[model samples]
Target: MVVIEQEPEEPTRPSSPAAEEQAAAAAGGEAVRPSSSAAPEEAAAAAASGEASRAAEEEEEAFEDALTDEQLREKARSQANDAKAEGNKLFGAGQYEEALSQYEMALQIAAELESSEDIRAACHSNRAVCFLKLGKHDETIKECTKALELNPTYLKALLRRAEAHEKLEHYDEAIADMKKAIEVDPSNQQATRSLFRLEPLAAEKREKMKEEMIAKLKDLGNSVLGRFGMSVDNFKAVKDPNTGSYSVQFQK
Candidate 1:
């Protein structure tokens, strides 16, 4: 008889770690190890990202701390001064539209400031001049009104509103504003001249209104007198210009 040796066969179902290990070893493989560089690279990336975030926050805080309220106001005033200077130059050159732009820029800066009321008033007054040049009477009046509200003694604003009122046929309002302007500055020759000029116009308007009232009253009187065979034309009131008195007469 010949002697023969046979190899052991694999188990149909694994029962333990030894069996699994043997199985893996039989398949010519081993357990994996942690990566050598991946963990370090990941950690370095996280640290860099955190540092960048912190740096951004610090930069924002520094920026905020750099400018206090007073400092910002000072900066705004300085810029407004420059804009006003530029606007003055443009206005002197008769470039009204361009001057208006510079004045508007000054106003924008002035609005952001805390202590530039005079500057704001000046900007509005200058804009009123621009609107006047542009033939925008209503806009001029509105701008001057804003300026006057800021500085009630603004002579320019008073004069401009008076002029606008005159143009719009508001004679009484024009005279009132002119009187105020004169009252505010007694030595203002322009206001005095304007007042003198407006007085005659106001007088004429008043006389015309009186005449219109008399005419309407006469018409109503005539309607009533028609029932009695008489008319308002039969009655007359004559004024004595010297004494400023009137005398009534009736026709026979």
Candidate 2:
């Protein structure tokens, strides 16, 4: 035989003074009078205030419980859209900081809602534009990255991030973003033009970096070879054109 477990009963609590007074009146006994009328009035007011607060809390809980998930999402979307529209207006007016704040508000409102990724991505991209307008290239890149993380195919985010990278002289990163943007929208002239412009800059930067690295290596080699009564210049490196390999030779 299986025995069922039972919940323990709650302990009885003592009644309040007002409850006792009402009980006494119901029992045909005179209620004990308070020292001052103000005391009872204050106590009654406090009780009423507490009851109203509890009632309000219950009503709010009930209302929230009554709403379907779709209804809540729709409400959040509407709010986010409103904030985003305000941001656009501010951006048009050249109030970049204010526009950023509005986009932030939109992001906050939509962040927790299910299926709100598009709005969140849009807000992040808008914030990136604001940062770009304010000359904050790093922040623009960061916000655009967040937008792209939400929606990798977001053309505006990709373009904005590419622009930010270009501002920071990050030619390779700018070229990569432009390439991705072109992949997303092949017909976009802006991305196509940006990719064309950035490729040359990236190539030049790569060459410059290669030269700098080789110069540093030469300096280090000279430092080590000088102790042996020799210099790096005394050695020559010859490249085999067909094999694409280099061989070092010792010279006087």
Candidate 3:
């Protein structure tokens, strides 16, 4: 027999050494190691991604913290402006009541805002105009007074108050207010013209009453038959039929 001696049986490898190790590692829940050459880059990539995620989180937190109280106030002011715009639209359309409500709400909001005096003055003036249009003279006067208090030199408020006084037949008060307005702004032609127009009517009416009173006083003081002035018997009166005029003959 040729080379009858059998070579020693080759050593048998375990059927699945790597599979068993993976199963053991899986059971133990330990991370598997990557190949040594690629491991550093993979780890660096993971670290970079983790760092980026953390940075993004921190940025979001910082942005949230930056929303300040002034921003909130500005937001409120913007909303008030929106309300005022709506009111202006309605006022343009001649919807006085609706516009008044919008303006009032806007004014309330504006009052809470800082440095809103101008807007408040405008609101008060607008409300007064609406009230005047509605024939609410007292309310109009009240609003105008408030506007004047807010801004002492507000010409519109002064003019409107004078007009309200005029409407109430308080002529002297109206004249005084108009005078003050004109003093403040000499170029105000309306005030000047109003004074010119009203002053004459007032004077004329007073003069007419005074003339009537004087005539009554003369009649009461002098008797019709006073001897020095005249006697009915001594005075002769004649009526002319030829002319429409009556002729009176008197002896001196």
Candidate 4:
């Protein structure tokens, strides 16, 4: 079992468009201009061409107005670290929804600031765990997938995704993932034990299904004997592969 650390709650709401502009301004950049109030089709066409140059120019002006790229990147990293810390706090308090929000913020900042694979993997895995707590199996799977794609050797991502797959009744996929995780981290007792449990259950299920099929075939053969007014001992049974059925022949 992956020991997921809880994240903290988000300290504030998401930054609005206005806030994003303000942040840019504070950094010496201008805010992005709003699109014109024309019909969407017309606006899209305009935005597609030079007509949208005005917005681009406004954004450029903001960029020129802000601090250096290095400074902006440092600021983004700092903000992201703050969000990550908050997420950890929320997770500790069992506020999964709030924790997930903060993790998302941290991930967005990481993407923009550092392109740091490690931080991105952590945030994705954290969000996946939060989704698991919220009982959102599909979303958990998605987030875990993202984390794994970022770092294939990420043990927590593999284990958590396997759990989510089990919740979805995709047992084979779950087993496959767990096996990979075990290969990566042989010291993980939880992964090893989970594999142990799944292997036996899978074998047992197959055995049970085989037994059921055999019992069904026996009943059908007996019914055919009764219809022929003969006991099973009085006849020999042969299967016709073409029709997939047994034919009884009178004994010599």
TM-score of 4: 0.56
Query: Model 4 segments beyond 4 Å from truth?
Result: 1-67, 205-252
lDDT of each: 0.87, 0.87, 0.79, 0.82
Candidate 1 C-alpha RMSD relative to the actual structure: 14.9
Clashing pairs in 1: none
Better of 1 and 4 by lDDT: 1
State how far residue 171 of model 3 sits from its true place (Å): 1.5
lDDT of 3 by residue, 1-252 (tens): 113576854544446988677657756978657545657889899789888888998888787767666787888888788888888898889999998998899899998889887778878888888888888989988999988888988989888888887788667767887898998899999999989876876677666776687567546545665746655445444556887344446667
Best by TM-score: 2
Count of backbone clashes for each model?
Answer: 0, 0, 0, 19
Q: TM-score of the candidate numbered 1?
A: 0.60
lDDT of 2 by residue, 163-240 (tens): 999999999899899889889988999999888888889888977886697679789999999899788898877778
Lowest summed lDDT window (length 10), candidate 2: 26-35
How far out, in Å, is residue 99 in model 3? 1.0
Model 4 per-residue lDDT at 94: 100
After the best TM-score superposition of candidate 1, give how far the Cα of residue 118 lies from its true spot, in angstroms.
0.6
Error of 1 at 228 (Å): 8.2
- Residue 50, candidate 3: C-alpha displacement in angstroms: 22
